[model samples]
Target: MKRRPRRTIPATLTALVLLAACVLVAIVAIQLAIGRTPIISYRSVTGTLHSIHWNDTAPLIAGGTCALLGLLLLLAALLPGRPTVLPLTGDMDAGVTRRSLRHALQNTAATVDGVTRAKLKLGRRTIVARIRTDRTNTAGLTDAVRGALDQRLDQVAPLNRPAMKIQLRATRNAP
Candidate 1:
C-alpha cells in the first residue's frame, strides 16, 4: 500500500498525553470506589462543575483555548512534512536521502575537468552548484560539469529530475 509518513514526535506526544489522562482518571475512579480521598477531590470537581456557567468568562476562555488547540493539532496532522528521502525510479521500495544525493552530485561536479572545489545546494526543484577553479580561462567548464552531472544523474535515476544550475568562480579574477 502507498502510505505517507506521519510526524512521529507529535503523534507520540499526543498519545502519551492521552494515556496519562486515562491512567489518572482510572486511579481517581478506583480511589472513589474504595472510599479513599482522590488526588483531586471529587467534591471539588463537582462543586466546580456546578459553579460553571455557559456564559461565564472562564468557560469562554476555556472553550477558546480548546478550540485553538484543536485547530493546531488539525493543522499538524494535515500538513505534509519535509521529505528526507526522494524515491527512486524503479519498482523496488528504494529511495535516496537528500544528504546522500547532494554528496553524490557534489562529487560528480568536482570530478569534472577544471573544477577545483564543488559545493551544491540541492533544492526541491533544482540542484545549484558553486564550483571554484584556479584556471584563468573557464571557457567550456560549465557545460562539461553539466554534462557530467547529467550522466551521473542518469545513473542515480531519481524519480524527479531537478534542473541543474552551475555557477563557476575562478580563485582569482583574470583581470
Candidate 2:
C-alpha cells in the first residue's frame, strides 16, 4: 500500500491568508478604538459594497474568481501525492526509502565476484541492474549478480518485488 502525503503547502497558504486577514481586521479595529483614521477607509468600502448590486458585472466577475480559487485550493488539499517509500513485509510496520533500496540492490550486485561496478534502477514492473565487469568472459556473471540481488531482496522482503533484469558491459584487458 502507498502512503499519503501531508497537505503542507495548501495548509500553510490557507493559514497565511487567514492570518493576514485577521491581522488587517485587528489593526483596523485598534485604529478605530483610538479614533485614528484607518489605513483602509471603512466609509469608502461600505459605499462600494452598497453600490455593487448582485447583477453588477464587477461583482459577478469577483465572485466567480473567488469561487474558482476556492475550488482549486480544495482540490489541491484533497489530491494525493506520490509515495516516497516502498513498503516492506514484516511482522511490524516497516518501509524502506526508494534511494536506500536501490543502493542496497546495487551494493549487493557489486559484491559479486568479477563485478567492478554496479548501477540499479527500481521501477514498478522491473528492477534493472547494469554492471561493469573486469572479466572478459561474462558467461555466468548475470546469474551470479541475479542470485546475489535475490538473496539481498529476500532479506529485505518488500511487498512489491519487481522482476529483475541485468545488463553487462565487460572491459577487455589492455596490453
Candidate 3:
C-alpha cells in the first residue's frame, strides 16, 4: 500500500483559520452581554427583516482570503515529496534513510588526512562530498575520499552504486 504524506502544514493552517473564524463569531456574540444589537445585522438598507446587511469591503476581503487559502491547500496536495529512506540491495526489503547515509559518508570523508569537516549530498544517481581540509594538496584528499566512500558503498551495498564527486576546499586558518 502507498503511504500518504503527512499534511502537517495544511492541517496547522486549517486549524489557525478555524480559530480565527471562531474568534470573530465570539466577538459578534458578545453583543448579547451588553444588551445591544450585533454589528452583523439581518436587516438590509431597505429595512426588510428577510435580507442581510454586510459591509461591502468585508465580503470581498473575506472571499479573497478564502480563495488564497484554497489555492495554498491545492498546491500542498499536488506537490510531490522526497521519500525519507532509500532501499538497499538484497532479497529482503532493507533500506537506509538519507540522513543516515549522509552522516556515514560525512564521517567517512572526515577520516581523510588534513580533512577538518565534510558534507555529503546523496542522490539516486550521484553522491557528492564537499570537504574542507588543512592541506594545499587537494589531489590526495580527493583520492582518499573516493576510495573511502567506495569501500563504504561496498559494505552498504545499496540498490544503486551512485557515482561519487569530490569537492575539496582549503580552510583559511589551517596550519
The candidate that wins on TM-score is 3
Q: Could you tell me how far off, in angstroms, the CA of residue 94 lies in candidate 1 after the best superposition?
A: 5.5
- What does the lDDT read for residue 130 in candidate 1? 98
Displacement of residue 84 (Cα, Å) in model 3 is: 1.2
* Model 2 residue 147 CA deviation in Å: 7.4
Residue 110, model 3: Cα distance from true site in angstroms: 0.6
Per-prediction TM-score, please?
0.68, 0.64, 0.69
Instruction: Name the candidate, 2 or 3, with the larger TM-score value.
Output: 3
User: Mind giving the per-residue lDDT tens digits that candidate 1 earns over 89-157?
Assistant: 988988888889999999999999789999999987899999999999999999999999999999999
lDDT tens readout by residue for model 2, 114-142 = 99999999886689999998887889999
Candidate 3 lDDT tens digits, 2-115 = 134577989897899899989877876787567788766634424652353455666678889989989989888788656567778889887887789889988988987778
Cα lDDT listed for each candidate: 0.89, 0.89, 0.79
List residue ranges in candidate 2 displaced over 4 A. Answer: 102-154, 162-175
By TM-score rank, best first, the candidates go: 3, 1, 2
Which runs of model 1 end up more than 4 angstroms from their true locations? Answer: 1-3, 83-85, 90-95, 110-121, 130-147, 165-175
